[model samples]
Target: MTDLAKTDRPRTPVLDRVTLPSDLKGLSDRELRQLADELRAETISAVSVTGGHLGAGLGVVELTVALHAVFETPRDKIIWDVGHQCYPHKILTGRRDRIRTLRMGGGLAGFTKRAESPYDPFGAGHSSTSISAALGFAVARDLGGDPGDAIAVIGDGAMSAGMAFEAMNNAGHLGKRLFVILNDNEMSIAPPTGALSTYLTRLYTGGPFQELKAAAKGAVSLLPSPMQEGARRAKEMLKGMAVGGTLFEELGFSYIGPVDGHDLDQLLPLLRTVRARADGPVLIHAVTKKGKGYAPAENADDRGHARGRFDVLTGQQAKAKSNAPSYTSVFARALIDEAGRDDRILGITAAMPDGTGLKQFAERFPRRTFDVGIAEQHAVTFAAGLAAGGMKPFCALYSTFLQRGYDQIVHDVAVQGLPVRFAIDRAGLVGQDGPTHAGAYDIAFLSNLPGFVVMAAADEAELVHMVATAAAHDAGPIAFRFPRGEGTGVEMPERGEILPIGRGRMIAEGHSVAILSFGTRLSEAMAARESLSARGISPTIADARFARPLDRDLILKLAAGHDALITLEEGAVGGFGSHVAQLLADEGVFDRGLAFRSMVLPDRFIDHDAPYAMYDDSALNAAHIEAKVLEVLKIGQLDRRA
Candidate 1:
C-alpha cells in the first residue's frame, strides 16, 4: 500500500482494454485479479483528485471486478446500495474518462446514476434502497422485460435499515431468483450499530455455538443410510445452532458463506456459482475491509470514508483553514453546554453522529447519546418515547435524511405534542452532494404541521441562542436548522440566551422597501441592501427567526411600514416565503398597494457545484435579491443595468 504519485500510477494494461463489462468476460481469473488490483489503484487515484467517497469503493474493488467479469451487465442489472462503493463500477462501466470529475458541476456523479450510464439500472445516493430497486427489476424481468438476473450489492450497515428487511420479506414471499450480496465490511460511514451488525459479527467470528455446530455437521454423515432421515434432522439442527444467517433462512432466502470480499479467488468462484445455479432469493455474506488496499485509509479513523483532496504520498488532506467555526461545531458546543446543566437532555442520531456534530455531544455525555444505526424512522419514534418518558430528547438528523422519518415525526411527536428537539444539520444548499442531499423541503414540510416550532439560524451566534431556546421550550416539538459551511465570523457569546418565541430582530430601518429573511440568507439580504443603498435606494433588512409562528407582529409591522416587502429564505417555494405570502393574503395586506415578492429556491433540483454558484443558479444570491427588489419597485432591467 505505498503512496501513489501523479507520474507513478499502477500499470493496468489488461484494464486499459476493458472499456465495458463485455470486455471483462474474455479475461481469465488471474488476469481479472490483476485487473482488480489495477481498478483499486485507479479508484484511489481518481478519488484522490476528486475528494469524494474512498473507503467503500476501495473495499468493493475486487467485488466490482468480479461482478463485471461474471455477470452480463447492462442486461444483468447490478444495483449498488447507497452507491458510495460504485466508483470501481463506474471505472469499469466506461466512465473512467470522467472519474476525476466526481461530484463536480456538469461532471460525473459521485454515486451510481442510471442516466449517466446503461450499466447503472437504478440511481441511489441514500442507503438501503438497492434491494427494493433490484426486486422491482426482478419483477419487471419476470413480466417480459430483458433485465437479467437482478443483483443488489448492499452494505451490512444498510441492511440494518427497516426498508431492506421490508424488501427482503416481500422478495422472500415472491421467491424470485435474485442475488443480494451483503457486503459485510463491519462499517458504513461510521462503525455499524444495532442487532443486525451484532448478528453478522457472530456469523463471521465463530463462537462456541458455531464451533459446536461445525463439529455436529462433521459427525452427522457418520450415520447409516437407514438413519439418513436422522442425519437430515441432525443437519437442520446444526444449521439452527449455527449463529449466523439463520434469520435470513427463516425469511425464505438461501444463505451462502461469509466469504472474503477482497480475495478475488474466493469472490470469482462463489459469484460464478451463484450466477449459474441459484434459485429463489440468495444472500451471499461477503466480509470485506473498508479501505482494504490503501494503508493511509486503513490506518485512519472512519477508514477514509469521505475525504478532501489530499497528498497521496503523506495522506495529508488539503483542508482549507477557516477562521470562523463551522455551524456544526457551533451547534455542538451549544448543545454540550446546555446538556451539562440539564441532565434530562438526551441526544439521538440515525447514523450520522460525526456529520451532525453529535460526536462532540457523545464525547461529553456518552450515556445520554444514542446512534440508532441507519434507521431514521426508528430514531424519530425512539426520541418520541424518550420525550414521553420525560427526557428532553434532541433528535439530530440531516435535513435530507429527516424525510425518511416524516411519518414518525407526524404520528409520534407532532400529533401527540411531544417535546422533541430536532437539531437539523446540513439544512441548505450543501455544495457537492447536490439535490440528493439538499435540505430544501424540511421547512415547508415541518412548518405545515400544527404545534411544530420551526426555527432557522441566521448565523452561528444566532444558532447558539436558538439552541438555548429549543432546550428551554418543553411545550411541544421544536426544531432548529443550520447550513453546512462555516459561520459568519461573528463574535462568540459566553452562553446562549433563551430568546422569546416567534420574534425577529431588525438589522436596519429604511423607507419604501423591507427585505425580510428567514434563514442564513440574511447575509445575502444585507449585501443586497448595501447594493440597493449605492443606487439611492435604502431597503430595510430584518431576520425572521421563526418560520412556523410567522412572527405576526413583526411581519405585519414591516408590511404596514414599507411600500414593498420581499420574503427570502433558503428553502423551497412552500416554505417560509409561502407562509408569509399566505399570511399577507389572508390579512388583506397584498390586496392593498403593497407590492409583495417571495424569493426562494427555484422550482427545480439544482446539481452539484460550489455553494455560491448553486445559489446563483437558483436565483437566490445577492444579485438575484437586488433584481427581485428592482422588479418589485417597477424598475426595468435595462434601466437598473444603466
Candidate 2:
C-alpha cells in the first residue's frame, strides 16, 4: 500500500556476488565493509516485504559479516543466543533467496533452525541458550569433532538469564577454548532491566584498567611475547579508562573488548586477533545500538524490534484495523480494574512488558508491577513469595514461555498452595511465530497440578469474569488461558463478576447431541451447532469455563441427556477433553451407552500460518467439528452411504 516493494530496493553490487559466506573470504576489508552495507540494505528490504525482526538484524549487520568472513561457518560454529538477530546471518549463509519468506507457512524460520540449514548447528527461539550450546560444540571439538571454533554471539539482555551464567561457569571449569561475543545493544524486546544491564552499562562507560588488560594477556600465555605487549596496551586503550571484565575474568575467561560492533574496521581486526591468538575462553564485549541504521527503525519506539509490512521510506507500519479488542488488552484492563480495588494486588512478568500487556498496567501501577528480566523461573517463585506474604500476585506470561517456569509452578506455588494468579496470554496456535511460541501445552500442564484451578475464556467478556475469579481465589494457584488475537465482538461487561468455581453454563439446549466447548473454541462449536441445526439436528452447546475442577454435575447431565457428547478445546490431547473423558470414566457414564468424542489439537506440532488456517489443518475448525458430529451421530452421511 505504501510502495515499500518498489522505489526502496537498495543496490547491492558487493552483496550480489556473495551467494555464500565462503565468497566473503576473498573480499578486502573495504569490500567487506561495502558488503555489510549492502547486506544491511538487503536485510531491511527483505524485512519490509515480510515483516519479521527489523532492529536486531539491523544492529548486528556488521558483526554478522565479520563473523562469517573470519570464521568458516558449517565448519566453525556460531550460535546466536535468541536468533532474533540472525536474519543477517541467514542472508550471509545462502538463505538470501528465501529471506522474505520468514515466519510464513513452509518458509524460512524466524529463528536459527538446525533443520533449515547446515550452517545453523543449533536451533533457538528462546534466549540465553547460546553459551551452553557453544560450550557443547567446543567440548565436541575437543573430543575429536570437526568443528573448528565455537563462537556464541549473545545479546546483553540474554546474559541476565541464569542459564548463561551456568554455561559460563561450566565452560570456565572445563577450561575450553571458546569465544563469546557479547552484543551489548542496551535492549531486548523491552528495555532491559536488572543489575547485569547496569553492570554492562558501567563496563563500557567506567574508566579503563591497565591491570585488567595485563591480566587478559597473562591468561593467554600462548601469544608471542612482542605481540602480547602490543595487544595488552591496545586492549587497555580500547577499553577506555574502565576497570572492566573483572567479573568475566573471575569466571575463567580472558575478557577482550567493549569494542564498536557496527564498525567493520574495529570488528574485523578484533575478531581476527581473537581467532588467531586466543588460547582459552575469551569474552568480547561489543557495544552496538539496537537499531543501528535506517532512520525510521532507529528513531521508533521498540527500536523497530518486530514489525508488520511497513513503508520503508516513512517507517509507517501497515497495521490492519482490528474489528474487536485483542484478548491481551481485555486481560490487562480487567487486571487493572481489579488492582484498583485491591491495594495488595501485584503484577509480574518475566521480560515481556508489552507482549504480556503489562505495559499499560505498569503505567497505572508502576510500583506494583515487576518485570524480572528474561527469568521465568524467578518470576514464578517471586510471585509465590508475594502470595505467601499476604499479597495478591498475578503472574502473567505467554503460555509457551511459562513452560520455563514449570518446576516453580509445581514446587513453589501448587505444592505450597500459594495464591498466585497466572494469566496466560497467547494460549493457542499463534500465527507466524510457529510452534515455539504456541500455547498448546499450558492447559495440560497446569490442569494436572494439585489444587490448581484452571480456566479458559470463551470470549473477552468471560475473560473479565475469570480475572475477577482469579483475584478472589486465595485458596491455591489459579490460571486462565486466552488466545493471541481479537475477541469475537461480544459486548464487554462494565465489571467482572465472580462466578461459581467449577460450574459450566449451558448455552443452547437440545436432546439428540451435545457439544461441550472450552476456551476460544466455543465460537467454532456454536458455528457447528448452526450447521447441525440446518440438518434438523439441533445439538446442545455449553461453555465449560473451568478445566481442572471437572464440572461433574454439568458434564454428567450432558452425558445423560444427549445421545452423543463431544468435548472441544484449543489444546493438546491431555487437557480439557481428556479430563472430561476421565471424569466420565470414573462416573460410569460410558457404561450408559453414550457415544463420546473429544476434539482437540492434534498430536503433531502445527507450523506457522494464519490462526484459522492452522486450526483447519489441525482439524478443529467449524467444518471439521460439523463433520465429526455428523460421523459420530451416524446420521445423514452414514444413511446416504448405506
Candidate 3:
C-alpha cells in the first residue's frame, strides 16, 4: 500500500475488522471517522467499477459512520428509507473487500438486504419505507422487553410519499421509542416542492432563530429566581408560537435540530446528545448536500442522482459508440410525434420525468405535463382523474415504480375502466441498478388486473405502433412496456398506426417448434431462430403483443401446429409466459403430447451488470434460449429412436 493508503488502513480497520454490528462497539470516535472517510473512498471506487448509485451514497457517508459508532446496530435497529444511501453502510459493516463487485451477479446488492447483513434490520429498495420498518422494530423490541433503539433515516424526497406521512402519524400517536432522521438535502432527484420543503427551510436557515435564542438567554440570566420562573413560562409560550415544529409537535414527537449534517463537529455531539436524552419519538432534521465533496455531481442537473462511470477530475461521462437509439429516446420521440397531432394529449410522471422520457413532452406542452414527486399512487389516480375530465393522460413510469401503485391500477383505473394510458419504461433487467431497480414484476401485477390491455414493444418501431394503439383506444386502461436501454436497429415507422387488439403477427413460418416472445426479448428470440435454423431445426417466431386479453386465436393456433411451444418474456413468474400457460391449461391444449417451457426471470433477485450478461445469468439470452431448444428436441429424438 502507498503512504496515503497506509495511514488510511485500519490497524484492524473498523470497516474491514468488523463483519457484524457487535464488533463496532470497541472502536473509538476518531477511528470511526477515519473509517467513514475510507468507506467513502471505497464506495466511489466501487461504483466506478460496478456502475451503480453515486450521489446518495456520498451524502450519507458521515451519518452512517456516526450512527454505527454511537449505537449498537443489528440489536438496535436502523432502517434506511429508499436504501440507495446504504453503500457506505455496506462498506463499514464487513463487506468492504467485496465492494468492487457491488451489483454484479452473485455479488453484494446495491441496496440493503436482510439476508446479506445482520446490520441491515430491514431490506429496502423503494423509497419512504424506513419509518414504518423502524416503527415495527420499535414495537417488537417493546413486546420482547429488549432494550434497543429504532432509528429511521429518510430523505426529503421520500418524505413526499403518503406512506411516510402515515407512518409518522402512527408513530407519533403511539409515542413509541423511535428516532426519525429526516436527512434534508433540500432535494430528492430534483429540488423538492410543496409546503414541507418550505417549513424545513425555515427550521434550518437560523435567521431569526439564533437572534431570538441569544436575547432570551441574556434576559433569563439577568432575572431573579422568582422573575426567572415567570420569564421561563413566557419564553415557552413565545417559542411555541414562533417555531415551525408545531406540525411534528402536534403529531406527538419531540422534534429537534435542523442541524448541519455535513459538519462532524455538529453531527457527532448532537447525535450523542439525542442518544442520551428524550424517551418518546424524536425527529432530527439534518441538512446535508447530495454530492458534498464531488464537484461534477454537485453541479449536475439532477445532482448526479444516478450516474454512470465518469472522469474523476472533469466529471464527464465515459463515451461509447451509439449503434441505435435508446428505448427511452425512442419513446420520447414517439410521444412527441403523437402529441404534436393530438391537442388533448397530456403527460404525467411520478418524479421520473427524465427517466420515463417525459422531459420532451414537458418542454413541448409545459402546462399538460405533471411531475408528481415520488408519488406513484397519486400519479396514477391523478391521471385517471384527468382522463375522466376529458383529457388524454399518458402516465409514464418505470415498471418497478409502477408496482408501488398496483392497488391504484386495480381500484381507480382498471376497475372503473378509465382511459389512463401507461407508458411503462424499464420493463426488463436494468444493468447496474440490480434487482431492486429491476422491472420484473409489473407484467405479473398488471396482467392480472381486469379490463387492462397490456402490450410489450419488440423494438422502437413497434413502440410507436403501441403508443398509437394506446391513444386510439380511449374506452379503457391501456399500457405498453419497453426495456431500459436502446432498441434494435429496426427501421423507424413513418407514421403511428394502431394494431388490432388481441391479435399478433408471425415473424417467420416454420415446423415442429414455435418460439413465442413478448417485449424486448423478441430480438434475442430472432437470434435463437437463426441459430436453430442453421442446425436444420427451423422454428416459428411470433411476438405476442397483448399479455392480458391474450390473442386467443393466435396462441391456440401456434400451440396446435407446433410440436413444442417455448414462451419467452422479460418478466418474473406469473407474467406473459405464465398467462400463456394458463390459457393452454384452460383449453386443455396440453392434453395432447407437447413440450412446453416458460422462460422468465429466475425466482431469485438478479444482480446488476450489462443487460446482456444479466439476461444470460437468468437464461433469457439467445445462447441460453438456443441451448434450451436443443435440450427439448434431443429428448424427442431419443423417444423417436426408441
Residue 245 lDDT, candidate 3, scale 0-100: 56
lDDT of 2 by residue, 489-556 (tens): 99999999998999999999887889999999889888888877777888899999999897999999
Model 3 error, position 552 (Å): 2.2
What CA RMSD would you report for each candidate?
4.0, 3.3, 4.9
Which sequence of candidate numbers ranks them by lDDT, best first?
A: 2, 1, 3
> Which tens-of-lDDT digit does each residue in 1-642 have in candidate 1?
323665556567888999988998889988898888888888888887889899999999988998888898888999999988999999898988888899988988887877799988898989999899989989989999875999999999999999999999999999999999999999998888988998898777872111112224464233223333433443565554754567887787877656678878767766776677677888877889999988899998799999898777777898988899999999999999999999999999988989989999999999999999999999999999999999999999999999999999999999999999999999989988888899999999999999999999999999999999999999999999999999999998999999899899999998888999998999998898888887788899999999989899999999999999999998999999889989999999988889999998889988888889999999898888888888888875524454
Stronger candidate by TM-score (1 vs 3): 1
Residue pairs in candidate 1 whose N, alpha carbon or C atoms collide under 3 angstroms: none
lDDT of 3 by residue, 1-642 (tens): 112234323243456676655565777767666766666666666676666678888888888877887787767888889888888888777787788777777788878888888888898889999999888888988898555899999999899899999999999988888999889998887677667788888776743221112225564443223234534544565565766456777787766555567666656655675677647888877788887666667898777677677655566777577788998988888888888999888999877777888887888888888888889999999998999999999999998999899889999999999999999998889887777789999889889988899999999999999989998989899999999877788889898789998788899998888889898888888898887776788889999988988998989999999888999999999999898999999999989877898999999987667788888899888877787787777733212221
Which parts of model 3 are misplaced by more than 4 Å? 1-39, 145-147, 206-243, 586-588, 592-594, 631-642
Cα lDDT, all candidates: 0.87, 0.88, 0.80
Error of 3 at 550 (Å): 1.7
* Weakest 10 consecutive residues of candidate 2 by summed lDDT: 207-216
Give me the runs in candidate 1 sitting further than 4 Å from their true place: 1-3, 6-8, 207-242, 638-642
Provide the global lDDT of candidate 1 against the true structure: 0.87
Scored against the true structure, residue 238 in model 1 reaches a CA lDDT of 53
